[model samples]
Target chain A: MGEHETPADEPPTDEARAEAPVQHGCPVTDSRGQTVLHPTREQYVDVVKALADEGYGMCVDLVGVDYLLHPNRPVADGVTPERFEVVVNLLDIYNRRRIRLRVQVPEHDAVLPTLFDVHPGTEAMEREVFDMFGLSFDAHPDLTRILMPEDWDGHPLRKDYEVGAIPVQFKGAPS
Target chain B: MTVSDPLVRPGYVATGEGGQEMRPRSEVTSAELLREVGAVLRLSEADAAALADSDPDVVGEIDPDLDDQTMIINMGPQHPSTHGVLRLMLELQGETVLRCKPIIGYLHTGMEKTGETLTYMQGGTNVTRMDYASPLNNELVFSMATEKLLGIDGDIPERAQWMRMLLSEMNRMSSHLLFMATNGMDLGAVSMMIYGWREREEVLRFFQKVTGLRMNHNFVRPGGLAADLPPGWRDDVLRILEMLPPRLEEYDTLMTGQPIWRERLQGVGVITPAEALALGATGPILRSTGVEWDLRRGEPYLHYEDVEFDIVVGSYGDAFDRYAIRLAEIRESMRIVHQILDKMPSGDYRIQDKKITPPPRARIDESMEALIHHFKIFTEGFKVPEGEVYVAIESPRGEIGCYLASDGSAVPYRMHIRAPSFVNVQCLPHMMRGGLVADAVAVISSIDPVLGEVDR
Candidate 1:
């Protein structure tokens, strides 16, 4: 089993996984020594739940990345690139480890399952994502505009959103 | 009408979907109550159910008159005790706070949006404004993330790392000192505020001397620092170290021993360890729960591994514990600063890479190529390799992290600051849930949230 093992007699999984590592049914890639798992939109919550069960208890950060221009950005194999990516950094404090989950969301649908059921701390972070990226979270307790006014229009963090283009009315003279 | 049109339409209400206004108690459903209670307590399903059954009065479901008893009120967007523009919608029944929701974003200036427009060389200035209390920490995280993406994180000079540690520790002392002042002021010990500020000013004086600005110094940059330490910096640092110990002892006498101060904070705004962790609270708040997790010790970013210091923790996760933790943390930071003073290396302050670091000011005067390099670096900025990195360091408040995504451009494709205050502020409702309305100020002070960091 050790020295003269043929391809047929050998385990097919270990060598195959060495070429492309997968974790929690998602393609895992190492980005600068950090473990990054690329899970599809459908598998996002399940993978997060699985990781949480395995002791990635604290959800440290949740942010959205808009790839409107850089649509061809490199992702791990077997993962489809999408217009928007939600990055969640989970910390396993007991193990002193961190894992990042990058789930791709299409431009049209722009919705993902909420992490509130798992990590209640993400309530505000998810609201910020929804406020800044225009991506809605399904079943979020209060998915309101957090860092923007409740009445404000357009998500500001999207790549397509222009900067320094909002027109303002002068209070004193114009009226 | 096109959404991207620049013109403002007359009589258009914009159709924003959500609001922060608290609904009346009668309108709130049992499901919503369960969710709110579960969130505020961070309790598991069984515990939440158990609580509902045991204390129907607290859940407000059994008594129909409870709807009329509790009234929702706005605490602040401008209240003096709120720290900044943090508005809390509290449902109060007489003096007891029933449910609370923090309404933030009053200070949101779209700094992350601005980060995308700013080049890598100019990114420091944008991030430093977020956590104004510990601007150096914000700059340090941003610089570290940028350096990591540039594939030069390990090549940073020993002197630069020590210098960064020095400034970072000094900033922590000053920030905690400010917290001492504010925490005292919030809890009604007015004189302690003056003493706290006076000591903090001593630390800021050193910062101003080294960085040329007090707050929002952007001194720590990607390659290393904006400049080398000013002449006689060691003596200045020693002076801060010399001045702090006794002043801190005085604070211990002024506020720590006072019975009134103890009454205000002890057993008030209490949170369990699981709730604190589940809420993703870090730094003093998490430490106050006796979880000995400090990123400086756990992750060992920069040269923290070489330094010897103890992580200050508290047994009870109450306001008193949070206050005591911060006070003790000031001493721990000073200890770290002393270690840095002894271990501070002598060499170049920034990295010597020609591509990332601009030509020295002296070189730009003599050679045309040096002048062009300097101009190009300041104007176009250096391009970073395509990658994304999340760099978190223990800031004065909590874990201030920078998540930078590079598209191999001079400007970051998407720059996001995982601000600690933004996450820590979420604990306010959980902390204030069953406390008196007056204790809310003490709760807010214990958290020590800087709104710029939260709203950014």
Candidate 2:
């Protein structure tokens, strides 16, 4: 995104940037006003354990997004400490409730506590995250590349990682 | 010999005359798999041309099918029930499943990691890849989470909400239609393969009418939908509505009451009500076990609070119950689609605030502010002050959720999906225990797990 980030850019009006994080949950504000959700980052396991205590039993998915063009967080964070951030979604099947737990990690030793005791299903999901993003989970049972081969290098999902050998102009892709 | 489960056949897909009979699972061997994968993974045309071998899993049990003692059989990464590229290690004795372990992540693409880098509008397009079968739910869930963080639920225009509900229900029907078609094909009702695809294509055609794309309509966004329903979109939907009922009846006659359907489905894949809750089954799989809960009714969102619809549930959580619940849900979805069309409020399709939606095509060139807002959303993107929100919807399969985190950036800080297929697949081993090997296909069909959602 550095290529697209013109030097002339201006921060949003104070009206858009002034909302602070909530005290208890650290819920953040979006572009809208007075939203109850506070956006804050925590240790990945703390977010999971907190939600489990709150009674959501399911850890459904863990997805990765490269921040090459992100305009908010420091794009270079992945290259330094707090470089990699991962989102964990938990669910309360009985109550039909849900919550998002976000955690940021520095690149050199990108590691976080595991939530395997809380949701055993996270075992495979975390491994795939490790396999894809190269983020390490401190206590994950078998944190190996779950999808890509062991020899694959660089996190394909990162903003800085070029698609490389994969032809960007492959034919027959869906429009 | 009589074979129970339906197969496309191993190197024997001629479909007519005696191509060959598929061997039962007990006769399959690991050496054969090692042999075949060893070849295909490294096979050239010389290796390919000489390949007269059938699919290894179907050729025969590479290992003994049933020992008096239970042995775990890995059904996929290649088989169908796990859906997509799932590998289910099934522990069984004779035909009864002793335990099941679902091994996943064969289709992980890490779209969540990609979402953190794209703008808000791009997130909608990125998240849609998670659940390819019913994509509107992904868009809706992501939009709702963003709206929750932005504190703009009410600001979303009435017309957009109404249109979203309509599209959601239609997406539900189309998704279930695919499930039914596949379920029927799995159970040997070949004509259902044709009929199910026909109905699904009709719905997809309607989706193309509104979103210009069929599978992943990135139309629903935080502030509102991508755009208004095209002129005559209501009529296009009505065409399918008019004909869908009779087609559903054909499916009912072909599947619901047939003796074999009952035997294959009933008493199979039994999960107790308690187990359904404990195992985290939602949507039809949980509801069929007698849990009368749906987010639309229990935790109403969008226009559900204003609409009239029943939460479909079955008394016993079995394969039959799961299958019936889907049939029932198709009816419920139809009812909601009608109410949305009849009561839709007309107004701006998206919020008037310049922060969330892109400036309309007309305003992009004329108004400077609108142009700036448009450029911001596409480039830098709008920021959610800093907060997290979880939004879930009742997709055709079950609960499809979007968990989003924002640190005042155009891209999400973190985005996680709580896909239902991934959850319901957990109960596969429990349901298959004590069931016949033939019942495995029935149970898989009833669960209707989609690998896209699971592996994502």
Candidate 3:
């Protein structure tokens, strides 16, 4: 009888059902009360476009983070956080709500589809991520070095990159 | 006195021992001279190739059809009109700009990478240097983000909130005033520069009185300010408020109606609302495009919701609209400052949580525990729970957000600044694409990008 009981027959509880973890293309709120969506690298563009359709028009910021050292960074259960993550912040101007999309990219193939087609503002930002973290954006029009020199030796912002400094010389100091 | 001596003038020759040969220097083209110099310097083809590869002036591919007529010109990493060390590559066809690409990183100090090394407590010092024009705004955004990451957003004192509002508003005024000065100079209104700087100096004097620095006031810290406002702070604020309104009117008289000012800005560098939104433009730039989206009004942080001020909007999204929006925003900021002075709270300037902030100097002298707590707070700095948060404030240039990710350590795992100038400068090409080359200066000045923030 318990198993066959209609769902409406059950008494309503005071507590709302905790939102189920979104495994596919739905948005979930993070612990910090931010609406974070974990979209697969394949669904990145579609998810972003869906959110954009829901009035999240502006792509406020786009940045890449190298979690090489901080592999233990928390994510919802059953979701595997990858070595490189591209975080995109979207703003719903009319509603004044913010949505962050975190897409995990594998180390071997650190390539993600470009959001430039959906959000033209991501052109420079995508270039910046490519320049800093050695991540690549497929179908990006001008995927060239932005901040670093064109022939710069390596991606300087990666966690594993060496921190090198050149000693400053004074006018009268020995060479 | 040899007859065929190459040293002799070309027209005359020395035939005998007694005769003098005079040779005019061969008409050397500049290109020939350069070739000879290159040959003398032993510049090989490999060296030439290397130079071309490393040359900062190397322009990207231009349209093949117009390449013959379009000449690429470099405008700064040094020019005064650029406002900072911003370099622009302008492909010009006769006086019209075919395309303009803003090349940054001349002033890049890698502040985001540097932020990873500093503790949460020391984060303000690094961020404040990024947007040096609006230093306090950087401090405010960084502090707020750090506080949010620490989950102590509600723990900030009421007095600190109002103080933050007051000082940040004043910083906005100072930053706008600087734009006014530079904009005027860039557009050839040199006298406006003098007037603008004079007014800005007064504001800086007030900043010095409160924060102990004319620029880079890293006084705003996580959990609250470095210290409470000094005595007579209200009186000083009142004087500034009183002094500014009439000066604003004087600017109206000087430039608002001036034909040259109007001509240079009114219809130049027009950006549509769709373009502004798609480009993620915020602050005055977006507002100038008739979008009433201000973080203060839209997503109120601190006590901005409690304050009474109108979100200034512009009708036409042009250079003039941007200028008008900034001018009106200064007045609105003053109004907010006045409101703050009236409703200023009397309480702890910073949170009293000893774990986050150091103990008062007076308390340290009385209690050994206080001294130890102070030492630990400064040297070790309190750790934040592992999480990430992005907090943005309506900075003078635009939305300055700090995206901070914590790994349960005193130092942030990753700190990415969504610097408004960095994002806003991307729109320059959009604005300057088809405009006359002369209007490029007007457009760049109107955008008012701070290169420090852009490059960082």
| C-alpha DockQ for predicted model 1 | 0.60
Question: What's the lDDT for candidate 2?
Answer: 0.69
DockQ of each: 0.60, 0.14, 0.27
Evaluated with DockQ, which candidate comes out highest?
1
Which 10 successive residues of model 1 chain B have the least lDDT summed?
Answer: B9-18
| TM-score for each predicted model, relative to the true structure | 0.92, 0.72, 0.86
Q: For model 2, what is the error of residue A169's alpha carbon versus the real structure, in angstroms, after optimal superposition?
A: 21
lDDT by residue (B1-456, candidate 2, tens digit) is 236534453432332112112123443343443332231123345434433344434544333434436555667678754456866666567677644555666686656666766777788888887889889988899888888878887678888888889988998999889888888888888799899999999999999988999887898887888888789987887888898999999988998989988888888888776566545677898789787778888678888999998888888788888888888888888998888889998898888877766778998788998887777778877877665566777888777777676777677776777788877776776677556777787888888877877767
- Regions of candidate 1 where Cα sits further than 4 Å from its true position: A1-20, A168-175, B1-18, B42-62
Which digits, one per residue and each the tens of the lDDT, describe model 3 over residues A102-152?
888989999999987788788779988998999999977567777775556
lDDT (Cα, tens digit) per residue for candidate 3, span B1-456: 576564464322222111111111132222322322232233456644544454233322112244457666777879888979988877688998755667877787878899998888888899999999999999999999988988889999999999999999999999999998999899999998998999999999999998899998889999999999999988988898999999999989988889988999998988878888988888888999999989998899989999999998997889999988889989999999989998998999999876798988999999999999988888888899999899999999989999999999999989999989888887887788668999999999999999999888
Cα lDDT tens digits, model 1, B270-353, are 888899889999999999999999999989988999989999899999999999998888999889888888888899999999
True contacts kept of 3: 0.59
What's candidate 2's DockQ score?
0.14
Task: Indicate the residue-level lDDT of B360 in model 2.
Answer: 86
In model 2, how large is the Cα lDDT of residue B274?
58
